[model samples]
Target: MILKCVAIDDEPLALELLSKFISQTAFLKLEGRFSNAIEALSFLNQNEVQLIFMDIQMPDLSGMELARILDGKKNNDKTRIIFCTAYNQFAIEGYKVEALDYLLKPYSYEDFLAAATKAYQYFDRIHNTPVAKSAEPTATQEFIFLKVEYQLVKVMLKDITHVEAYKDYVKVHLKSKANPLLSLTSMKNMEELLPSEKFMRVHRSFIVALDHIDSVAKNVIQIGDHQIAVGENYKEQFLEFLSKWMS
Candidate 1:
């Protein structure tokens, strides 16, 4: 699915850079660009955009204030945000507004691509789009290719102990490796890609291998060293699954 996006930055150079980057991305369509938040706010009020690449600090109105305004709007719930700023101090604030990613200024193309990919995955999940068709495994398929760093690493589904959500990315913990495979994707995407019988989303931030779980205690599923809490929303289904093991 193509995401309609806009860039809001006070700096001409920054706006130009963002416009260029958005143009290069395959799934992103540049709807508009603004040098200040005021014009962007007016544009957003009239038009519908799925994503916004905005600078936090702007003259007259800051991006944070713009986000607050957008958050209050009923029609802007689907508008995802990616904050592009020079200061890393605004990272926490960006999270408060449910931003898809935070691009630290002077970032490289790889960093930008990663953030863009995360946004793509976010939209793909919400819209139920099959953008990553090649990554999807068939019923008989045992492994999947994950884009890690620039390489498509082949990983066996059975080897994954659990999936951990880290901001815009997901860390796939493998039993065969000491380090988990960090990919620029969301937990929702991972949960949808995995087989329902073998893997289950036990928490908003976690998906665990049901067969790999060592025990269940205090609403937590233990898989090796990892302790994943069962979210309140998913607890009923999880408890029903546990009923099969009761004596």
Candidate 2:
């Protein structure tokens, strides 16, 4: 069945781009396009939109703000989201909002297809489950808040690439930011705190953001310019992950 989809962004060109993409894919049916989040919200209340392609920046209401407004409701509508943004700074928060994936501005048709594929799989997974969602544990998995503890730290939840283990300490690689921050903690503990579906512990020293992965070489996984090794034990699971996108 074709999935009902909608696009929301203030830029006319951006909406045009999404429209073109929807036309290319037979399974995606464009239901509506909104220039702002408020209009999109009102339309959602009355329409059956199964997927949303949203922009992070808009007049009055931003996409991040819009995600907050949609959270924790029993829509049971199985609507998936794919955020379209220009800035890499929003990548982390994009995950926080549990976006299926994001399309960076200037992205190619292949890129949009990739993110859409992920979104489709996500919606399918949730629909087949007919399951209940357990509440998240509080006081667990707190983020590395930025700029509060003096100048010594400033990496927010939305700026991290991965956390590497160094004995009892773990090193966090910041997104598009110079230098990684060192934290005294076990990688195992961190894996528990982070949403397992989003962050994968492919190595004792590496817990990477699945969406940030650029390429996976024989022994290394590339997140932009950084090259991370694939531990022997975790190699199978990593390969299995790549299999999902093989098509």
Candidate 3:
């Protein structure tokens, strides 16, 4: 999902940095850049924007005042703000206006990406769009992106054999690869992201793709060369599914 956004900062260099950061992010699109809040307010009146990266301190109109004005506009609730400034003192004030996030000046690209990802998640929930995307999906070609190291690796849903929990991450075992894809995300998150109709959590540490199961033996599930044990807490549900499968 691409979020239409603008940058508002009095300093030319700051606006440049925000513009550069937005360009680097995959999900963000730069709609406009303003050196002051007044011009930005005027432009905002004519255009619809999903987000704003604004400076707190400015001449004539301040970012906080603009946020309040935006809060009053009709059908403007979709637009969110992330304040960028040098002073950390106004952090509370920024949130009081209900800004989505606050970025202190000299923030790195990593920090900016984190805030943008948060915004993406918010939009994704309300819009019912997946944060991860591949090529146009058919009935059977659905896919998702996993953060592997510094890259977002796309994995087709049909290729996922099973998911295993690492200490702080999840290992996505795929049919097309010899090794599992390691991502720095929790198992709980993986469970939520995958469609419930296609993937089932059979253990506290394992989520197996329903179509990939080779056979079920007692409390164990066999998928290719791997044998996964069903936890006691999940055994009943697994059995229920097994009954339905056999019937």
Candidate number achieving the greatest lDDT relative to the actual structure = 3
Candidate 2, lDDT over the whole model:
0.73
Cα lDDT of all candidates, in order?
0.83, 0.73, 0.86
For 45-130, candidate 1 gives per-residue lDDT tens digits of 88999999999999899999999889888966589899999999999999898888899998766566667766765665556645
Error of 3 at 34 (Å): 0.7
Give the winner by TM-score: 3
* lDDT by residue (tens digit), candidate 3, 113-181: 657766766666557644466464524326666778877666788999999999987899999999999
Pairs with steric clashes in candidate 2: 92-158
Flag regions of model 2 displaced more than 4 Å: 130-247
Deviation in Å, model 1, residue 198 alpha carbon: 9.3
lDDT of 1: 0.83
TM-scores vs. true structure, each candidate: 0.56, 0.54, 0.59
lDDT (10s digit) by residue, model 2, range 88-138: 899998888777778889876656655664555455545555345456432
